[model samples]
Target: MATLAHLSDLHLGSSASAARTLEEAVAALADTELIVVTGDLTENGRTAELAAFDRITAPLADRLVVVPGNHDRCGDDVGAQLMRGVRVDVQVRGGCSIVRIDSTAPHNRVPWLSHGRMCQQVLEQVDVALGAVPDSVMTVVALHHHVVPLPAEGFWEQVSEVLHLPNHSELALGTELLKVLRSRCDLVLHGHRHVPRQFIVDGDSARPLRVFNAGSTTELGAFRTFDFAGGRLLGDPRWHQVTPEPRPSPQVWQAPVCALQLA
Candidate 1:
């Protein structure tokens, strides 16, 4: 069985850098066929910060698939440069096929900005990508925002509540997106809540549907590993946590680290 790693919301160059945890995650998941980063690579999408992220993840070069979060596009041309690793939707031979979409609006800091909007253009793209998945291959889709509210419990709930001025999730659009993917995909991976969640979303069809929120890998030290065989998920995902070491250097990233290579 082949293994896959799921991580999200590193938020680098912000309050704390989880360089150590990231390193550990790479080491721990070294054997996985692919490492899918859902979004929020940098705290503010600074060129330097993205470069640092590239350096930290370069060892996994060919095995990485990344997507953008609201923060990743904050800098100039970051979206174009960073979108390569953010490969959206594919057919993984002998493994699973994945479809990823950009769920972040250019402006998300506004009171009404946090909500995820799934417009017609985006839906059509998803429809085309997911519609072609071969039945033998497991299908997975990814996005930066949550399709469901998935409120956390207790103290975490309080923090999540305050973080949102007005909770505008991908309610309607997510539903439309799901309609296209429900039968096409088995797992839908995403992260924006910064809190890990594993649950089943029941659509009209009875086929098993799963959703995962990887949370902030750099912040909460949370991640997951999935085993697959014959292009199907084997069983329940294994969750992991790590204690990160402090950043070795206090320097920050403000300049472009590499040339733009988004294809």
Candidate 2:
């Protein structure tokens, strides 16, 4: 089985503490086959900050798969340039097909607007990418935003929406994106909210879709690994952390059996 590490929200330039935690986390993953960073690489998308990220993650450069987050797009177009004009990335490693999606919202001068969105064009691109993968391979999709609303998001986001503030918490068109993914993929991984979460999106298909959010790998000093083979996950995800204390189990949410149409 292939071992894959999932990490997110490094926020490298934010503080010295976070950077140190990131280093420790990376060290623990020395044997992981692939390290997927969902996003938030830097506190601000400055050239220096990006450089710091590159330097810190250089040891695992060959096995890294990264996508930009809202924090990574705060300043200029550097993050976009790093993406190389590719919104969807498909790669096969260790018998698993991983498709990464760029879910960050379009650039705006307002830095506090941290919500994500997937337009129709990007959704179509996801379809094309997944179609190219064979049925025999386990398919995993990674992005920077959570597609379904988590319990941790409800209270604050509802307040933001009621106040008509610009800081919306939910991903626009997320439901549509979830529907598209549940039909085509076996697993989905993401991060944005700093809380780790897991959910099962069940449909009529034989295999239900599993989704996991990695939270803030730097701040939380934690990451998760999965074992996969023959297009299926072998067992429950295992959490690794820099601290000695055991990581808390993530809250589980289950999608409706018929169809997932969450509002």
Candidate 3:
């Protein structure tokens, strides 16, 4: 079995608090075998912000598997340049096959939209990559946008709902992506909503696909770890919290309950 540390939405360069939170979280991940970051490494995809991210994560670079988020593609194409235009990156590490997909909306087409979509070309790439992976290995798909809908848990999320904002925090082609991933991948990991959640998507003739949405590691002081063996999750993922400073009293927190199951 192998262990994977999942982190998302660091939003570095957004504030000093965010940087501190990420530093603490990274410090706590000394024992993890592999680290997976879903996206939003920066608040505005600026060169300086990317540089800061590189500096902070330098120690963990060898084991990190990352993909770009909407925020990472916002102002400039630096994120894309950094990633070298590879939309589907497949890596086999520690007995697990990880497929990282870029789900950010095209900046040239939708400059102002926060919603993400997987184009036909990207979907085909995903299909080809998954087809190449052996069935014996545990398969995982990581991306920036949530394929499954999550509840409005934060203040901004609630406000967006109240305003009925179109395409706010949405994956425009998520259902189509789900159709492609449900039967092929054992686990789907993402972090766009900044709310930690887990759910199962059952396929008609294949095993259920487990989906985990990681909360913001920097903003919400949250991350998770999962164990996989024989192409299955071992147990409930352990939820962890990182605070900028030590609290006088130890605080208790529970993992977010699975809100929805799709058939």
Candidate 4:
């Protein structure tokens, strides 16, 4: 089976204590074939913050894939240029297709579907990336901001002014992009909201797509491990929390969640 390590919302500058969490998470991910970070790598998208990320993930450089969140574009430094958006389509071990899409822009800080033109272009880019992958392959699309609302409806509504479309047409456009990807993929992965979620889309009838939201590793104490084989996705994800040791503790602390299934 092929294993992928997924985490998001590291939010490095949120606190100095956050480093221990990063170290623990990275240690857990060292063995996976691919490591996917959904977004918000930094608390404010500062150069030093991003640099810290580069250093932290240095050992896994060749296998890591990352995208930007609203926070990554809001601060002083130009992160887009630093990361070059890190958008690309690649094949994972066991022949699964992995597409990393960049949905946020450097100048656009607020989280919204207001950048319709850019969103359309990125969607088209995703389509092209999928087309290049063989039909027999299992596919996983990764991004920063979530395309669909999560269980935390009340919280999302507050940011809907910048995130969701006020009208159905705009909403349709945002969804259509995902629908197109669903046609050729087995799963979708994203993170922006700090809460963990799993959304299964059965609207296609003929093809079912599972969207796994890895949530925020630094903030919510959540992360996932996926198993795949050949070109098919197999088994449910194993989620766990990485607890931080007290300042005086001599060694790092780790926690395991026995009941990790998500509907």
Candidate 5:
């Protein structure tokens, strides 16, 4: 089976101690085929913070799958542009197609999400990436947001507050994105809400179309691991928390189900 390690929400340079989270995650990803960093690479898109994260992840630089998070684009220059657009990074090795899509919101801190409509555009780009996949190769989609609603338990409450601040009607959700995804893909992986979760959108009995979201690596120090064979999810998802201590915080929440498979 081919194994991939996933992590997200690394708010680099947030607090002086946040670097420890990066170290813990890097240590955990030693043997994985590839590393998927969903988003929140930097706290405020500061060059200093990005530099710090770059140094930390340098060991896996060649094998890294990177995407921008809301926090990473809150600053200036290239960081701002990265937030407004979606980036597609494809890795073709051993005949497997692993695509990383940078699904970050626009960098305008007005009301709700800045680039809600960008998801559609990103999906369009993803279609092009999928075309490159061989008939027998596996395709994995990576992003920085939850395309599916996670369990309520205070997770969405915090997100709702952040994304819905100063505006309250529509939210930048991923349901529309998922509807499109269900038709042409094998698995969707993402992270942003700082909670770990896995759900079978096409039904539990299904075989390949699965959605996996990794919890936060910055605040929670947790990640997701998946095993695949011939583009099919072949084993259970391993959810692990990597903090030096096992203490829990308000940001730390349990996933509904540790793992799932969708067809």
Candidate 6:
């Protein structure tokens, strides 16, 4: 079976001390057919931080898939460099066609915008991109924003308050995008919460879709290794969290058995 790697929230300049973790992650994912990065490439989207990450991921450039997080958009370019390198929506190797959708809010001046919004045009573009996929291939939809509110409260809330972190989701969550996505795709991946989670969304289609957030790859040293064949994921999802210590975090989340569980 072919393996796909998912990583997110590098927060490069912010998490620069995790240099060893970055090195290990890149080394670990070197063998995967595709590596999906769900944004937060830098602390504030600085050129140097991007360069740091680019240098770290240079080995996997040919197979890399990425989307910009709010932090990455803080720079003047609005993570334009990240999008520039992603030339195709579908993989030439086929089997899996991953379409990247930008969920970041608009910010022309000083890149002040945060949170997420899909907009009608973005949804239309997402539709057009999916049209390029073949029916036989499995589809993976990726974006920087979480369509639904994730559990980020309690102590985390206080911490965020202290850190001055803004609202995690967009002022207007484009649930319409989720409704549209639920009908067609097999898997949807996103990461902005800086927390790793696996969830099931019941779409109009009989087959429920899987959603995953890999957390902060560089800072938290979190990442996922997926076993898939013919564009469909196989068995349970096996995710790993690399810690600074000798011990690492390994977690498994199985596909839900009951449809109501999703509801």
Q: Pick the candidate with the highest lDDT.
A: 2
- What TM-score do all the candidates reach, one by one? 0.79, 0.87, 0.85, 0.78, 0.79, 0.81
In candidate 6 the C-alpha lDDT for residue 6 amounts to 83
The order by descending TM-score is 2, 3, 6, 1, 5, 4
lDDT string for model 1 (32-62, tens) is: 7878898888777688878878998988888
lDDT at 151, model 1 = 60
Relative to the true structure, candidate 3 reaches a TM of 0.85
lDDT of each: 0.68, 0.77, 0.75, 0.65, 0.64, 0.67
Q: Put down candidate 6 lDDT per residue, 73-172, tens digits, no spaces.
A: 7765447666664422544432577888766644522344456666777777777777776655668887877776565545755566567665544325
Residues 51-115 of candidate 4 have per-residue lDDT tens digits of 88989888888788777766777666444754464545464543566787766664445434223
lDDT of 3: 0.75
State how far residue 137 of model 4 sits from its true place (Å).
2.1
Which regions of candidate 6 deviate over 4 angstroms? Answer: 85-94, 108-113, 153-166, 170-173, 203-206, 244-263
lDDT winner between 1 and 2, please give it: 2
RMSD of each: 9.5, 3.4, 3.4, 6.4, 4.2, 4.2
Which pairs clash in model 3? Answer: none
Which runs of model 5 end up more than 4 angstroms from their true locations?
Answer: 77-89, 93-95, 108-116, 151-173, 204-206, 247-254, 258-263
Residue-by-residue lDDT tens digits, candidate 3, 1-263: 77888899889878998888887877887767788999888888888888888888778777878888888887764458645778887987767889988887565234446767778888888888988987767888999888766677666667777887644555766767777877678888898876566777773345667788886777667678888788766877776777844322223224444534444
Shift of residue 36 alpha carbon in model 2, Å: 0.7
Give the better candidate number (2 or 6) by TM-score. Answer: 2
In model 3, which range of ten residues has the least summed lDDT? 246-255
lDDT of 2 by residue, 52-148 (tens): 8888888888888888888888876445755678888797776778888888756522466777867898888988888898777788898988886
- Comparing 3 with 4 on lDDT, the higher-scoring candidate is 3
Candidate 2, run of 10 with poorest lDDT: 249-258
Q: Arrange candidates, best lDDT first.
A: 2, 3, 1, 6, 4, 5
Residue ranges of candidate 2 with Cα displaced over 4 Å? 151-159, 203-205, 244-263
Encode model 5's per-residue lDDT on 54-97: one tens digit a residue: 89988888777777766666765224544344366676643356
Scored by TM-score, the top model is 2
